[model samples]
Target: MKHEDMVKSLSERVPLLKKEWLGIYRRMGEHPHAPKWNTLCGDRLFEADLESVRSFEGKLQKERLNFRELPPESIILWCSEMERRSQWFESVLNGIDIKNDWCRITPMTRRDMQSKLEQIVPLDADLSRLVVNPTSGTTGHPIPAPNHPAAVGCYDPLIQYALRMNGLNTDCSGDKVAAIQICSQQKTIVYHTVHSYLEGAGFAKINLEQNCWRTDESSAFYINDMHPVFLSGDPYSFLDYINRGIEYRPESILSTAISMEKIVRDKLHGYFRCPVVDMYSLNETGPIAYSCPHDPSKFHILPNDIFVEVLSGTGEPVPEGERGEIAVTGGRNPYLPLLRYLTGDTASMNYGECSCGEISPAIVNLGGRKLVLFYGKSGKIVNSIDISGIIRSFPVYTFSFIQRSDYRCTLKIAAGGELTSRSAKFMKEKIESLFDNEIKVEIESENILLKEKTMPFICELEL
Candidate 1:
C-alpha cells in the first residue's frame, strides 16, 4: 500500500491500533528482558501514527528551510500556530475562562505535577489506557508520571529530528541501535528486540557489569558482530566501555541521561571517529533538544513537540542570552500534559541563526538541577558535576556520595580493579580543595550496588 493510504487506513482504525499496541506492551512487560524490550517497542511506536508523524516531520523540515526567509510577521504567525496546537494549554485556558492571556495561568514545577498528576492530565483523557512511568529522580526525588501510547510514540519523530540534525539520513532501513546501561534485577542482563518502523532493523540493550558479561572482550565481540548503527548509553556506562577497551566503532554515539564532559566526548570521538550527539531530555517530557551538528554546545529545541521558555527567578521571561530556569510547555504526552513546568535546570537562550540552519530556539550552557548542589563551609555551594568529574577520572567500578552533614560527606566507591593509596590520596585532596578544606571527606572502598534508579548524589543533611 502507498504511504498515504496506509496512514489513512491506520487513522480510521485508531481504536484497534491502540488495543494492539497495548497488548504488545503488556506482553513485552512480562518478558524476562522487559525493560529493554518495552523501550524498543515504545521507540518504534512513535512512528506508528504515520500521518501525524509525517505532518510533524514536514513542519520541522519547513521551519528549518524557511528560517532565514521568514520575516518578523511570518515568525509571529508561526509561533501563534504552534500555540494553537497545544491542546493541554488550550484546555487550561478554557477551564480558567482566560482568552488571549496565556501568561495569566501560573507556571507549574516538578513538585506540582508529582502531587497533582490527575489535575494536570486532560479532563477527557482515558486514564485506564495510559501507562505509568516513574522519573529516574536524577535531579530530585523520584515520582510516578502518567504516559499514553501516543506520547511514547512521539519519540519516533523527536529521535528522527535528532538524527537529521546530526547529518544522518532519516531513511534508516536495516539500521540497528545498541543501548548499554544498567537494568533492573528482574530483567535479563542482555537482550534484543526488533524495531517496528523499519524492516530488519534491531535494538539491543546490554548491561556491561561484571555480573552481566564475564569480560570486556566477550562483550566487544558480541557488539562488533551486531554492528549497530549507533551506540547509546549514560556517561558512566560509556566511560566503562572506553576503560574496558571495547573497540567497536559505530556510525554515531548518543550520550543521554547525564551530561558529557568535553574530555570524555573528545576521547570517544578519537576512538570511534563518529559524531557524539549529546541528547537533552527528561522522562516526563521525552526528547526536548539535541546538540547541533555544527556546534555541540548549542542545543536546538524540538519546537514541534515542546515549547521552551527561559524564565527568571520571579517567573518572568528573561532576555535572550541570560541564564534562567527552563520552563517547558506543550509536550506530546497526553496523559501528563504540562504548562510552563519549571524543569529545575538552568540554561541561557540564543536566538541567533545556527550554522546548521536549524532556526529553532537554542539553549546554551545547559546545566543540571540546582538540587544537586551541596552546601560547603562559609556558604559555598559545591556542584555535584565537579565532584563526579574528579571521581570519574579514577578507575572506579561505580561510586556514590552521601552528604551526612553540612561539613561531612561519605564516599562509597566500588573499585574496578585496585584502589591504590596514591589514587585515594589524590581524590581526597581534590574533593577537600573544592570545599575549602573545611569539609571532612571520608572515602570508603566497598561494593556499592549500582541499581537502575540509583542517584549519584544523596543529601541527608537536614535543611
Candidate 2:
C-alpha cells in the first residue's frame, strides 16, 4: 500500500480506538488494571495498521541480512560525495560573481538558517517534495528544517552503523520498537511506522505520566507483553520508567533529546542489562554521533553525512581534546544545508582511533545547553536530569524551577489556564520529597513561554 493510503486508514481507525479505550477505562472504574487497557488498546490499534506492520517486517529482514561496512576511508569518500551533490555547497564555492574558496564563507548557525531558510536551499532544489521538520524548541526557539525524502532515507544506514559498532545485530526478525516521547494532550499515541530499511518493525509512542497510565505496574506489564526488541526515549521518560520498576528488557535502548549523565546511564545499564546507546542527534541535523558501547564517553561521529568541528568562542578551532562549541558542516538535509553550523553544544574531540577500530573522530566529554546547578542538603550539586522527571509529571503547558538557594526555590508554571490548587499541591509535595524537605518549595502560576534556549531549572544561588 502507498504511504498515503496507509496513513488514511490509520487516521480513520485512531479515533475509533480512542473512543473504545475511553469506554473501557470508564467501565473498569478504579480497578488496578484499568490503565493497562490503554496499552493493550494501543497495541491492537497498531496491529490493525497492517500495511505499516508488513513494511517494517520487510525492512527488518533487509537490515539483518545486509550490513554496510563503513570504515574511515569510506566515510571520507562519502563526505566528498555529499558536497558534490549539495546545491548549497556549489553556490558557496561559486561566490556572488567569482569562484570563492569554501573557507571564505562563514559557518551558519541555527539562527542563521532560521532567518534565511530559503536562501540556503539549493538553487535547483524542489521544495514541493521535501518535508518540513520543526525543531522541538528545547534549546531556545524552534526552527523549521527541510529535508528531501532521500536525505531522510539516510537514517537507516547510520542507525545500522551504530548498531554494528556496538556488536548488536540489526536483524530482530519479529521484535517491535517502543518509543516513548511527549504527546500533546494524549496519554499515548500508538501507531505502526516503518523505516525504509527496517520495514515491519512494530512502533509505538507512549507518554510517561500518570495521565498516560493508571499505575507503573500496568505500564510495565503492557511493555513485557508487547516484547519490544528495541526501546527508545528521552532521558526523563526513561528515568521515570526505571523508577516505576519496569524490568522488561529489550535488545537495545536508545537515549536521545538531552545529554545522558553518568548516574542515569549507570542506572539504565544496571537495570536493563542491555546496551544503552546514547544518540547525539538534532532536528536540524539527524544522527550526529552515537555512543560506543565499549566506551560510552567516546561518541563516534557520523562522518558520512555530518562533518564536526569544535571551535572556541572566537570561531577558531580549539586545540584537540579541548572543550568548545560544536560546529557542523555537510549534511544530507538539502533544504537546510548546514555550513559549519554552531550547534549549541560543548564537547572535546579526540583524533586518536577508538579501541573499536573505527578511525572516525570521536566527541568526548559531551555537554548540553548549560543549566544552573541546584544544591542539595549536603551541598551536593543536582543535575538538570535529576529534577526533569519530577517536573514532567505535571500536565502543564510549560514550567520552570528557579533555585534561589540551597534551602529555598520557586516553581513557576504556565498551564494555559489557572492551575488548580490540588495539582499545585501535588507538584509541591513531589518536589519537597525529592529534596528531602530540606528545601522550601513555592509554586506560582505564571504567564511564561518556555524557550528552547532557556534551562527549565535555573539556580540563582551563588556558590
Candidate 3:
C-alpha cells in the first residue's frame, strides 16, 4: 500500500494524523525513488518542496515507490544519491534571483510576515503544489507558514534516512529497545524505531518536566530487560541526565528539536559517552537539516527537496561567509510551500566544499530562532542552550531559565535524584556571570513540573 492509502486508513481510525499530515504523501509516489510518507517533521530534518506535488498523482509519479514499506537497499541507494545531489543542488540554488520567476520564488519581510502570512501565500495560485506551513523556535514564537505539502512529506523520510545513516535503524525488527522522548508527556511521536503506535519495543517514557533526570536501580528496573539502543531527548532534558549523571548509558544518544551549545553538547556527549546529533527543522516547514556524525559543526540540508538562502535583514542576499537570516523553501509537502520564508534562525552562508564530499548547502553555527537576546552592550544575543549549558554544568535534576528583563533572569530547577540547595547555588553563579549587568536569579525547586506548564528551553516570540 502507498503512504497516502496507509495515512487515509489510519486517519479514519486516528483522526489526529489527519491534522498532522499535510497531504504530501499522495504525491510522493510520483517519482521512481520514494519512501513511505508517514507524517511531517517537527524538530527533525529539512523537508523541501517537491515540484510535482500540486496534484496528488503528480507527487507520486515523482517518487514512483510505495513508502509504506521501505527496503533497506532503497534507503541505502537514496543516501548515495543524496550525497551526489547535495552538491548539484547547492550550485543551482545559490544563483536564484527573485527577479526571475516569482512563481518559483518570493520573499517576505519578517515584520509583515508574522502579521500577514496567510494573505501572502496565494501570490502564486498556479503554484498550488507548494503548500503552507509554520515554524517556531526558542523566542521567535511562530512565523506564518505558506508552503507546499510536498516539502513537508519530504521531511519524514529524510529524517528516518538520516537516522539510519547514523548507524541506527528505525525499523529494528526482533531487537527490543527503548527511547526517551521529551516531545510530550506520553512521548508518543513514533518517528524512531521504538516510538511506535503498535509495540513500544519495551520502551519506558519519562517527561522531562517530571524531573526524572537520573537513572537508578529502580529506573533501570523499567528498562533492564531490553538493552536500549539509544536515549533521545532535547539538550535541556539530556543535561538533566548529565547533571545527575545517567546510571545506564545507551550505545547511542540523540538530541534534537532544540538548540545545544558546544559546551553543553560536549558535556552531554561525555556524560552519555556518545555523539550528540543535532536536527534543524521547524514545526510548520518540517525537518530541513541534520548534523552528520562525520561533520558536527555543519548540518547537511535535505537537498533538491529543501532549497535554502541566506539573506540579510533587508531582504537582500548576503555574501558567503557572512552572518544572515536563513530562509528556506521547496519540498514534497502539498499542504504548504514556504516561499522565501524568513526563518528567524541566523547562520553563516557556506558555499565551500565539505570534507564529507556532500555538495548541498550546509549551515554552520545555527543560532536558533533569535532566542539569544542581544543586549545592546555588544549586541550579543544569548542563545537558549547557552543558559541551559550553565545550569547543566551543575548537579540540577531539571532546569528552565526565563528571560525576565534585559539583565534579570529566573532559573527554575526541578529536584530529582539527589539534587539539593548546594547544586542550585552552583547553577545560579554559573549562569549569572553570563550576563555582564545586574542579573536577578531566582531558583524555584519544583518536585515535578506539571505537563501543560512544561516550558521547553525556548519559546517563540509572541506577536
Candidate 4:
C-alpha cells in the first residue's frame, strides 16, 4: 500500500490518529538506513475498541488483582458466550458441567490449534477482522494462532501495567518512539508502523543482523536515534543488543517469547541502568504475566479476564502452590476463545499479596514450554527440566542443548567469561551423568547463543 493509503486505512480503522505523530511515523519510514520492510502491518483497531482496551487497563490499575478461582464465574459466562457464538465451543463444551472446573473437559493443546483452528474459531467471528499470527514455536509445534487487531492492541496496556508494577512507566508523547520490538534472528519480518492506541507514537519491529541494515553500524545508529520509550524483545535479542554496543537507553525493557535467566536479566539491568522486565507471553495468548519487581523468580498475572490454573497430567487441578502444567481460560481475543488451554508451561500458583504491592497470585518457578526429552547413549530418556536445573546451578548466561541421533550431545553456553574452567568442567560432568554416562557432553563457552536463533533444547534421536 502507498504511504498515503496506509495512513488512510489506519485513519479509517482508528479515527483518533493524531496529526503531530505523523512526522515521527514518516521519519521512521524515510530514514536513510531504514530496514527493507517485508510488509506493511498496523494495529487494525477501531477507536471504540482502543477505548475498551484503555478501560481494561484502567481497571487493571484500579483493581487489587486477586487469584483466579479454579473456574471463575466470569469464565462460566465467557464459555456460555463462546458456546452461543462459536460452533467449536458448542460442540466441545456441549454437555460439560463448567461450573465445577475444567477437569472433565479435555484441555485444548497446540495440536487442536494447529489442525482444528477453523472449528476453534467462533462462528460469529468476523473473518475480515481476524489476523493469522504465526508463532515461532520454540516448543517445536508452531501454529498460526487466530488473533484480532483490538486483541493485539491490548498488549501495550499490559506492558504499561508491567512497567507500573516495576515503578517505571512507558507511556510517552506522540513525538517520541513508543516501542521497538527487536529481533536478532536470521529471518524475521521487519517493519515500522504506528499504533493508534499509542496515539500514533511510532513502533518498529527491526532485526539487528547486519544484513538488515545499510551498514554494520547503521543498526546501532538508527536505534540510538529512535530512542524508543521501551524495548521489547526476547532474551537472545536483548543479549545481541548488548553485544552490539548500542548506547541508547529507554525507560524499561520487556523481554518476552521465552524465559530469561536471572543472570541475563541482571546483566541487562546493570548495563541499561533500567528495569529489565521478564514478560511471560505467547502469540496465542498475548502477555500472560510479567516478572515481579521484587523477585525475578515469580510472575504476576497481567489480564483480569483470564483465569490461570495449574493442572496435573491427568487434567486435574493440583493443590494450591504445587507445581503443574499452567492452563489458562478466558481471554479478550474475539477470534480465539481459550477454554482450559494447556499452555505447555509449568509453574506453581501462589495467592495473596506480593512485595510489589500487587494482590494477585504470582506464578512461581515458571518453566518454559512442555517437557522435552532427549535420548541418552544407553537409550534412556532425559528430561529437559533436569538439564535446566543443572544449568541453573552455574553462572550461565544463555545456553543451548542439542542431541543427535547417534546419542552425541553438545551444550553451547554463553556466560560472558563468568564460568571458570573448573566450573565448566563440573557442569559438563553433571550433564553427562544425566545421560547415564553414555553421551559425551561438549561445551562451547562462547557468545554464540546470543548471535543466532538457538533452541534451548533439541532432540534428533527417533523416539
Clashes of each: 1, 14, 77, 0
Model 4 lDDT tens row, 67-124: 5546767678888888888777888788887776457877887557755888888877
- Misplaced by over 4 Å in model 2 are 1-103, 173-190, 214-216, 369-463
Top candidate, metric TM-score? 4
Q: 29-119 in candidate 2: lDDT tens per residue?
A: 2334334224322222233333443443344334222111112343345434535656545555454321123234456776556556666
Better of 2 and 4 by lDDT: 4
The local distance difference test score of each candidate is 0.62, 0.59, 0.48, 0.77
List, residue by residue over 114-148, the lDDT tens digit for candidate 1. Answer: 55665666667776657765434455333456787
Higher-lDDT candidate of 3 and 4: 4
- The numbered model that scores best in lDDT is 4
Ranking by lDDT: 4, 1, 2, 3
Q: Count steric clashes of candidate 2.
A: 14
What's the TM-score of every candidate structure? 0.66, 0.64, 0.52, 0.78
What C-alpha lDDT, on a 0 to 100 scale, does residue 293 get in candidate 1? 88
lDDT of 4: 0.77
Candidate 1 CA-lDDT value: 0.62
